[model samples]
Target: MAFVNPEREEIKGLLEGNTTIAVVGLSDNPERTSHSVSQAMQQRGYRIIPVNPAAAGDILGEKSYPDLGSVPEPIGIVNVFRRSEFTPAIAREAVAIGAKILWLQLGVYSEEAAAIAQEGGLTVIMDRCIKVEDSILRPDIRRI
Candidate 1:
């Protein structure tokens, strides 16, 4: 069967329930989409964990981890900014680290990865921007 994401309402609840987002492939550069989006989420009261292997230091004032498994705290979501071709491995890592959600950023998706994440008990969201979704779901609320 083709992969299907959770309903809009369910997605909203997912956002409500999960406040910590581990961003895979997050960039240290403020000019990057990953950086801007993650920063926005952080401003919305969601904790952002940077998971870039090549990170020079922290991103957005939070210590950067090389991967999801390396993150010391529990992760609520794994938001991926990497290419579609790289998602399956990231999915496995998310699953391994017990993340509750695997979110593929806009224009990035992999059926194989989605299936892997779903089978591993993670809610899978593909080709969507988490910051946009959060803005749509909770427009009335902004932490900062």
Candidate 2:
């Protein structure tokens, strides 16, 4: 199979198409990158489901899940904010949970994880910030 290259257009399309985003490693602290990114996505009318083991309760007015398996509904996107070494596990869980997309945040990359997600037929994006993409590509979408 050809490589899954997430180009600018594909990233824009994913940002526009997916409405629910599960932010893995999202922190409760507003200062954290995950929180800021989730906030931005939430503002863009995307439901931000915080997925963090350390944070099990409510965050940003939404309940946090321990992992992808704990999320009750089908997630349109799994935006990971974890390290590259930890991405394979997240990718496995995301695939098992049937997430349509696997998004590794800026500064994170893992070829193995990308392969796993792609092998499962899930869209894979790495080393890019979703918030930046949304803001730059589709500014029409205002966050709530």
Candidate 3:
């Protein structure tokens, strides 16, 4: 069977309920899409945890971790900026860390990763941008 993303209502609920988001493959470069998107989410009041081995340091004023396993707090969402090929392992790690949502950013999608996350009891959103979704679903946040 083919995979389908959650409905808009469900997605809105996930965004409304979740707080801290672990952004996998986040880069320190402000020019990077991950950095911009994470910054937007942060402006909307979501805590962004940067996860990148090469750039494991302060990023956008938040502490960075080498990987999801190293994040010391409970992660509400695992927002991925990595390639599709890399997502399954990230999904598995997100599951291990007890993340509620597995969000693949715009232009990134992997059926294998979605399956892993779904089987692990996580809500999955693929080929979508969390920043964009929040702007659309929660207009009140956009005003801020």
Candidate 4:
């Protein structure tokens, strides 16, 4: 399957329009990338929903869920922090839960997962860091 980087307009629209981000694999430890990124997004006015089975009870002052389906609110984006091999399951769940976008964090890639997301008509971004992209592309906006 072919992968595409969303245009500036699309990314801008997503950044401006969507506020809730489901961070799958989010960790409680502040040192972790997931925590930092999620925290950054939260500071940027986005509602960060941390999804981790181990931390199902809490995270970032919000109740964490076991998975995307467990999240009660509408998810604008599903930002995955798991390895590439773990993405298809998350992608399926994200699509099933009606997420508008599936974002695999930097160093993550999954052709199958991306294909599944794209097939379900959800916008997919792989091997990219949302924080860096937002910071570089939208410099005026501080990420935390």
TM-score of each: 0.98, 0.94, 0.97, 0.93
Best by TM-score: 1
Per residue, candidate 2 scores C-alpha lDDT tens digits across 24-123 of: 9999999999998888788778899999989968998999999899999989999999999999999999999999999999999898999999899899
Off by over 4 Å in 1: none
CA RMSD per model (angstroms) = 0.8, 1.7, 1.0, 1.5
Model 3 per-residue lDDT at 105: 94
Cα deviation at 135, candidate 2, in Å, is: 0.8
Better by TM-score, candidate 3 or 1: 1
Candidate 3 structure quality by residue, lDDT tens digits, 1-144: 888888999999999999899999999999999999998899889999999999956998999999999999999999999999999999999999999999999999999999999999999999999998899989887423
Off by over 4 Å in 4: 142-144
Evaluated at residue 100, the lDDT of candidate 1 is 95
CA lDDT of each prediction against the hidden true structure: 0.94, 0.90, 0.93, 0.88
> For candidate 1, what is the total of clashing residue pairs?
0
- The residue pairs in collision within model 2 are 43-143, 43-144, 44-143
Native-referenced Cα lDDT, model 1: 0.94
Clashes of each: 0, 3, 0, 0
Better of 2 and 3 by TM-score: 3
Give the best candidate by lDDT: 1
lDDT of 3: 0.93
Q: Candidates 1 and 4: which is better by TM-score?
A: 1
lDDT (0-100) at residue 79 of candidate 4? 95
